[model samples]
Target: MLLLRQRGSLSASQLADELEVSTRTILRDIEALSAAGVPVYVNRGRNGGFSLLPGFRAELMGLNQEEALALLTAGSIGGRQVFGLGSALSSAMRKVVDAIPAGHQAAATDAAQRILFEPQADLLSRYRLAEGISETVMNEVRRSVLDGRKLRIHYAAEGRDAAWRHVDPIGLVTVRERSYLLALVDGHDRTYRLSRVLAAEALAAPAERPSEVNLAQLWEARSARFRAGEVQFIVAARLDPARREELAETALAIVHETAESDGWLRMELTFQDLRHAAWAIWKLGVDAEALSPPELRDVLHQHAVEIAARYSPRGPTLATDA
Candidate 1:
């Protein structure tokens, strides 16, 4: 309809043919348009079909109820963070909504009211340093990947007291709610958590990005294969049937349940890490068991040892080697 208006005027049959719809549909569309305050005009006799009054804005004739409502919702979310752009987005949303048919306004408003988005705590908190560094590195890395350029970064590893090597940033990934930078260090692709990073600077000199190793493909493959030492440790656990169903919905572990035997259901799971798994098992207390990857069993044992040491007759104290 707006496009037809831009062309000055067209008959109902002409609009139906242009829009690839029936003539009745075009008449109904014109009626809806006019009812929405659009200056649509019709002329009778040999040469007249429909036309917009002179000086009428064409953009005002384009939006439908659904599109207007979606824009309004997006504008609200955007305005909460980037103030300047948010205001402009909100203004554009208003104009589009106002252009929609008045009869559809209530429906659009209702739809907008139903939409909701929950922002993450980490994102809401102004972690300026982490955000700024992550943004710069990601943008530069993406540009470098496209342009086939190399990057130098200063990073720190978890459990290490000092910052290590100037690495070539290859790709980035997010696993278990944390972000990591995947890079090539000494000819091998290594993953480094962004939270552990201290500082990163791109060397003026650029190295050629390798064609054989596509960062995105490599990340997907590694993620699928469940690569070792990738910030998460896999721990196997056996859970009772009742508990298995509760854990099935979580990404933290993959659970497999067995048939109930003697009124107790048996199941197994692969945990993302030991610390939380141990704590959870302690809560389940008697129903869960840390099955494999000796380290996980060791973690459970250590917890017990700590508890024993805390309440021992001599009071909490570490046993010293003779």
Candidate 2:
């Protein structure tokens, strides 16, 4: 029933392909469902397929109070189209609603509605273009991952031109609404963000991935490295009390700390690289001041001087003015 609801109709062969079974199996199952009083029928022609009668729906999986609350805690992430699970999540959400006792559905809906998700208005935006991904290319990418096959992809990395490459697509995931394919390139793992994928062709050859692939474990390891100060530097900054929470978001862990005069916080933080610290503190502006590590302070000073120069009036030499 769920499958029929997800797709209005399917031929026997198509159902067999999806279920990894023979067409005879699907035909027998169809007969059994009909025998059980299901409103299933088939159209016998070139454009015909098996379909459920209109307004027919099967009973949904039950959701206990804890399960309902857990889905509610997911907080519409399932509906955000992240990882392309929106349809499945929507169907699941409908099931959750349906499985609730008649008297409790309204209460569940009301509780979910009470939660709000507010995203910051960062200088960089995350919305997609109107003319989004090509259906053909995205389909091939997904096919390769699900089928455990290799892929020939035209990918572009940051600050470089696009190039075509062969990859073994292990899995695909969405982090912060951004899509990425975790694949093996040149026998090493690499994360290719979807925005950088210009084109893709799914290859029939099986991927050279490990027999046991764990997406969660792989993502966690990569994320830890990314947050662990790539170049490994110690940052000493005098931060205003107001920016305390802001600093927590960037650092992997707070290595050390101390109190300062006038409610300011002197902290020892870690960053991936020097460039990382430079670009990061630049944003905090006056809220944070790099104290130790002369190199970091130098970077900030140079940036400040440059900004001052841009706003300074274009003028003749001082001697000429005199």
TM-scores of the models, in the order given: 0.49, 0.63
Most TM-score-accurate candidate = 2
Task: Report the Cα lDDT for residue 292, model 1.
Answer: 70
Clashing pairs in 1: none
lDDT of 2: 0.78
**What is the Cα-based lDDT of residue 68 in candidate 1?**
82
Question: Which whole-number lDDT from 0 to 100 does residue 152 have in model 2?
Answer: 95
Best by lDDT: 2
Q: For model 1, how many clashes?
A: 0
Q: Candidate 2 regions off by >4 Å?
A: 1-57, 72-75, 117-138, 225-236, 251-275, 291-299, 302-322
In angstroms, the error of model 2 at 132 is: 7.2
Please count the clashing residue pairs in each candidate, in the order shown.
Answer: 0, 3
lDDT of each: 0.62, 0.78
